[model samples]
Target chain A: MKFEIIDYKDTRSGFGEGLLELGAENPKVVALIADLTGSLKMDAFAKKYPDRFFQVGIAEANMMGMAAGLTIGGYIPFTGTFANFSTARVYDQIRQSIAYSRKNVKICASHAGITLGEDGATHQTLEDIGLMKLLPRMTVINPCDFNQTKQATKAIAKHKGPVYLRFGRPKVPNFCPPDCEFTIGKAIQMTEGKDVTIFATGHLVYPALEAARILEKEGIQAEVINIHTIKPLDADAVINSVKKTSCVVTAEEHSIYGGLGDSIAQLLSRELPTPIEYIAVNDVFGQSGKPDKLMKHYGLDAPHIAEAAKKAIQRKA
Target chain B: MPEISELQAIASQVRRDIIRMVHGAQSGHPGGSLGCADLMTALYFEIMDHDAKTFDPDAINRDLFILSNGHISPALYSSLARNEYFPVSELATFRKIHSRLQGHPATKEKLPGIRIATGSLGQGLSVSIGIAQAKKLNKDEKIVFCLMGDGELEEGQVWEAAMYAGANNVDNLVALVDYNKKQIDGSIDDVLPLGDLRKKFEAFGWSVTEMNGNDMHEVVSHLKQVKSQTHKGQAQIILMHTEMGMGVDFMMGTHHWHGVPPNDEQAEAALAQLEETLGDY
Candidate 1:
């Protein structure tokens, strides 16, 4: 299958655009931010619907608690903040008030993982997916690009229970189809090949796609699947793709311990027990640098994914 | 308002329920539950404009109350059941499996009057402020009330919510601190002194009021006056002075009864002091 690159856009902008559209479409939607509207690209939503927006200042825990309460009055509240502040600073608040009670809240987290850049390890969150995954009823989504992120932002608003929507900071290739139907917990198969199953999420999917193209030049047929939603994983897709390939490679821009790779590993270990490889950050916090440089330094680029796919295929014997 | 005798009778019954429920369960917080018995009786019976018959999750045009410091579930469960949110006989099932009354107040079991869960400390004020904002947005004239413990003020998020409510002019909220001065370990003064909560909340932009929470007459009058003081450009906080355990003579002075259940003899002795006005479940 041939692929073309679309224009580059940040996934957070997709979330912002989705929020703006939600403001016009659903009057019950309300937004609360932790004093970082500009950073999260929420200026448009705040301006267009001033009455629905709440500037919650620097208190992320309070924002989460307030979001839970807003559900009592039949409002679907969307809370905005950095991923670190969104998850790490407020895990207990989210666990009790939102997840345990099953409140209709959308926790939109921008600047996830090492891609947050320049701001370094403190602002960058590598364990958010794992933290949210521990909650029983939380629906976790780490959409690949701008279009998918926007679709996910709108999708979670319609979902009744609590959600943790994760997106990135850097502008990546926005190649997802426009007007695509985004069903939560379903995987999007981008390319179909049989050599090694390549599963990716968030910022790493673009590089995984690019890696598939590079592998095809060398007669290696690598199938690439985008597992956007991490919690209610598409286990069937992972198992089916691995059934054909006999080996797998999982890629993510987060800590390999509890992120997408761990979920895929758990799925394969019990169901298929295939020899798998991973392309993710290895046991270290991120540092101040450009996002591209950080990706290359952290071994999360296309070449690294292509290498991992080859390693997993070689172990197939 | 209900007559003083009527309200006092309700409080006595709630106290009876608290001691009996805790004694029956063999494990519960009877001290704080008994401490806030009169407040719960007056608020649900005579003060707030809420309906016990037709239940609604939105709670539009109705007063909303949140138990922020939820360890005192016995008090809230007794009040909710006695006020007809559910069958009063269900109060006998406190802390048992499959019962709506949890060890901490929870909304997951579909308890009629509960809107949010609050087992962990210091989350209720933030949630109440959010509900107040919604009421203002929905053009509802009702007020939001939150009951917290003086020990819960040690949590930083309580102050965070306090600041947000004051700075944003969330004047439709009424927060009450159960100043029982006792925590699980020891006295709050020895554990971590709050250092003048009235002045502190006032500095955070609340219209502060102090009340004797155990006094039936004072509890009714203070809450009635404060309901009118809300929605006037300042939030309200009632620094209610209450004992850790108020009604029973043996449990009134110390924090030992904060979570200890009465054995058979202790139960009989404690039950002898408080008169039962309403029949036990």
Candidate 2:
């Protein structure tokens, strides 16, 4: 149960790195940023592939529609912006043009959740996963670290449908293997235990693993699984793990109402009934704070996940 | 070129199809549909250099038209059908369940001519600009045309698109606003007046053209003139002037008919005005 923190890396940089790689590999790949190229770490891709990059200056709704239309000409368009601006701000733009039309547009959203920090509630988005996952034909991915975010970003490009890849701004623990293999709609098991299952996504995934190791010392075994791809969720993988554990805890940096917990609850309630505890922000807006402090204040850190895991295990009848 | 009378004949039939389709479905926007009949008839029939024989949804090197104001699906469906995108008989399934011609334009049904699902108002311009940019990227010499409703300008997304199209030099796109000044709620002036549309478009850096959209010859000539003006680093917009219900005598000049379907007697009366030129579906 020992692991080394490889380094701290912002997830948006991973997305930018993946976009640059995609530019070299696929000629049909094009990118559009809503005047946040530097913030999204997309300057390299924009500079390297000038012909493929479109700077749509601060107009996110237009960016979404343009991305949808790019698919009409057989081009894969990856749109970049903050999570709040990406989803809620342009929900109809994405819904009608991209999701409903089944356009091959990758909506890459960074600065997700309260981890966007000092920008306050307006900039942070805790309901984007809920917004995106409800759309039909939308693949929602929330990778844990830089490596996984980059891998997820690259993975969505090859997928011929609408995808929402959520990442963050802070440079947290980048512990995932540098060359990790990423598959869409598949859950990656970080730890195997039987007392309780901790299903986590996005930035909270790293904390779930840390919670698992801490719980091991207390003679409690927590099965930690990273449910990166939320929609078309790895239902079989989830059902299998819950069957063995018989109790579950879902963690995310999103609202407890409709993020990973809702998706997993729907999965377990229909397939196999299990007691579940949620490690997410209650229905409320975020405030200005440091990223780490925000996670602690919102009770989304490792200690919160560990406590939730224990509560879930105790609730199992 | 097809005779102007021939185009007018097709428009006459298209107007018949518009009311009949709406009357058959028991719901639809007939006013704008009838108004744009002439413009779309010319675009699909003679102006566009598109091959109607083979329908490839992903074909390049062909002029494309998108109905942004999707409630006018009747006009787009009739035009696409008569131009050989699909069977004219399918027009009967306008808003029926399991019909490809949904109330709005969509690509999910894999409808031949529709490249993107529009009608969410204010979104089509941005999408057209995307295709125009794609045409530029591929070095493909084809123009992208989008039709919008005058009332839809109230949505901020349209202006966002308008701003993007001009600033990005999306010259390969030509957008047309159906200036019937009618929406579902009421007349655009009574509801939300769009003060000086041409000036607004000009301020957004678009090369604006004002024409009588209901006139077949003006529609054709303006489309051709705009095609020549593309790629000059300025997007073009045609602020078309037409009556709310252009072809129908009783329905013109009022916003009341914007969305209301005609009853049996009214349908008969409306059909009496539009001659059955190309035969009914």
Candidate 3:
């Protein structure tokens, strides 16, 4: 693996910009905001497509219902809110009106993970991916960086059915290729190696990349894969990578239980079982801190990932 | 419009199906289904511009109905089957293994008439509002009908949907609350009293109306009158007064039968009292 330093931006901004572009491209693309247009970067979409944008006040439950209603008449509704409000706040509404009904609704959530600093534990949501993925028809995506997030937003709008597109707020290094293909249920292999497979998603991808580079210097060649789509998981791709590596290190800015780490563990346990280590938020609430400080405190930084990868590789060896 | 006698006949048949289906499964909510028989019969048999043969689940032009109180799926399944959405014999598969007739309504099994899944309370209105909004966007002049259990109103999202419909003037939608005044736990009063439901809906800025949900004539006429009420700067809510288990004498006037199915002997007695009008499914 080669060390590549690159400029980065928050994936939430990519989602917001992509939403604005989607509104301009399609007349039927309607957006509903639950008092977080600015945070979600949906202000541009709202401003450009005023007629198509609906401000559902601060009522997230109503916004969810209205979005579902908008789907009946054949409008592809995109709902914008913070990750906390979008998942736990109106989970029942999403469960019945959207997922159960199988409405073609897009739930675009920003400020995911502890990257949303200062707002503290109440605002930071680490279990949204697990919540959305459990629904039968929901398509959950946690894109790693700006380019992938932007591409995922556009791609989800084109695909029918319910989608939960989660992105973080903090600016992270964009290592993915600018013209990379965004396919749901397909993992992107960033660096291929034989000692360990480091599967990562969302903001954690940058740390996994950094950890892979650090591990390379120590003679432990790590294979890094970006698992963007949590549901409709690419089992074949995961199994193939694990077969060669024999060990797995799962990383995400989410709870170790029921998050991306849990999904990977379940997959590996079923097919080509392997020893796996998790680099994620332990079972504890995050406190107010700077983004970098929170990442380190929560054991989600690069060194933590590297250590976890080393441990997993050692277990396999 | 379907003749009053024909709708009545359909309602009676729906009642038969509800009893037989619930009896066979030995599980399901029969009270709400029997209560909404007339309303569903009128909508499927007459009002809704739907087709039985070409049952395109997502056909945009036709009117859509969402059973928010999905425990009442026996009525919905019977209505779909009798209307020829699928073979009437498929009614035997209700709640059976691998059956599309899930205990609750679902689209996962590719059920012909079900566009969205509903069993959880207070969600149908929101879904109906979504379809209604879509209809407005596409210039589709069809109405979206959503039926909710009176007890389901306890869910806060129902009120949220009510507020959105009222605030947005979601006129192309009609939601009916089966005011049977009962829930799974007990009478709505015992569980959670929703005082002055009609007043609450009125306060929410909806064009409120009331009707005997069990009466064939009133159900048809009220729905007809309320049809054009949408787009008039207010949503419509018909507070349908119904007796839980209206047709079966044994189950009426008590919350005992809200979710529990009858034993074979009890089912026979219940079915014998309610005339087998259009023939059992």
Q: Candidate 1 docking category?
A: high
Task: For candidate 3, write residues A63-177 as lDDT tens digits.
Answer: 8877877775567899999999999998988988788878889999999989999999999998899899899889999999988899999999899999999998888887666
How many angstroms is residue B54 displaced in model 2 relative to the true structure, after the best TM-score fit?
Answer: 2.5
List native contact recovery per candidate, as a fraction of 1. Answer: 0.70, 0.73, 0.75
Ranking by lDDT: 1, 2, 3
Best by lDDT: 1
Clash numbers, per candidate: 0, 0, 13
Interface RMSD of 1: 0.7
| Model 2: how far residue B93 lies from native, Å | 0.8
Report how far off residue B213 is in candidate 2 (Å). Answer: 0.9
Error of 3 at A218 (Å): 3.5
DockQ of 2: 0.79
The alpha-carbon deviation from the true structure for residue A267 of candidate 3, after best TM-score superposition, in angstroms, is 3.2
The order of the candidates by DockQ, greatest first, is 1, 2, 3
Score candidate 3 by lDDT.
Answer: 0.87
Tens-digit lDDT track for model 2 on A209-273? 99998899999999999999999899989999998999999999999998999999998999999
